[model samples]
Target: MGVIKGIEHVGITVPSIEAAERFFQQAFGAKTLYALIEKGGKSQEGDEMYDKNGLEPGTRIIAMRMMRIADGANVELFEVEGGHGATADAPSHMGIHHFALYVDDLEEAAARFRDAGGTMREGPIELGGKEKGPGNRCWFGVAPWGMQVEFIHLPSPIALDDQASSGPRWLPG
Candidate 1:
């Protein structure tokens, strides 16, 4: 894909950034790197921030924190003054429904998720085809901050590897 490299980070909006950071830390060992816009406020004049960022009028950027989980994409949590925290109940909902994380041990991650106040879907549903490979168990859960997340563990490469152009997807180290 040329020298475009890859995604550096994914921005997520949360109502309570403190809780979000704590949840990610306790659930997945996410480490906070630094703060970008440490303070949250409006542009105060000409709706500059809103019009410039294409944000709705009066949407103030509360705060932002950069984080890393293993070697995956950096997680940027954004706290906005007018942001509404909506939790999705199904994967088919509109927009980006969820983000998946690779785990070496699904059970341990689930335990941490539960301990962090996340409500996980019942059963560690095992995939039945070669697409997901063998010994692959996928579990879905809601983060304490109302974000939907998936934890997947694949013991071996999936059959889809043969049909890929990007080779194998990146896994956390």
Candidate 2:
């Protein structure tokens, strides 16, 4: 619909927003866009926010931040009390999976991630098949906060992309 532009941001609950901020800054050069939000009755504002935002009852948010990485989608990080997702998830779970970052140089981006304490599981090899076509490469990895991340380089449109997506696929030049 014309009302929807595109992905505004993605929100994730981390064990510590401070650590998450550092990791994103070091790895992807994410710039903080705003101040942190601390919940749990620090002010009546927090309570009002929780109810309006559909937060879990008694959810104690230590901090939440808004960050922008490059010109792509923004990221919203939440640090909650007693959260257990301080490590990357193994064996894969349901719901939203990895977020792939479109990179000009997969090796260089992966290197930055590695330097910032991320881990990969091989690949970056050329992708083959009708949909992926040739010259497209992908590298899968785990973020410092244990989220799955991918560095993908798609030089051109994949096969049947026009039929699959609602709009034109967004890619970096």
Q: Pick the candidate with the highest TM-score.
A: 1
Per-residue error for 152 in candidate 2, Å, reads 0.8
Q: Candidate 1, which ten residues in sequence have the lowest lDDT sum?
A: 86-95
Candidate 2 per-residue C-alpha lDDT over 35-112 given as tens digits, one digit per residue, 9 for 90 to 100: 567554352223344446544434455667899999899988776553333233310111136788889989899889
Question: What TM-score should be assigned to candidate 2?
Answer: 0.79
Error of 2 at 32 (Å): 0.6
lDDT of predicted model 2 = 0.71
- Candidate 2: C-alpha RMSD to true structure equals 4.9
In model 1, state the lDDT of residue 52: 48
lDDT of 1 by residue, 1-173 (tens): 69878778877877677888899899889999997766644322214554444444445556678999888889988676653423242111122457889888888989999998898997688877774666888899998666789998878777664655757765655
Q: Please list all clashing residue pairs in model 2, or write none if there are none.
A: 88-146
- lDDT score for candidate 1 against the true structure: 0.72
lDDT of each: 0.72, 0.71
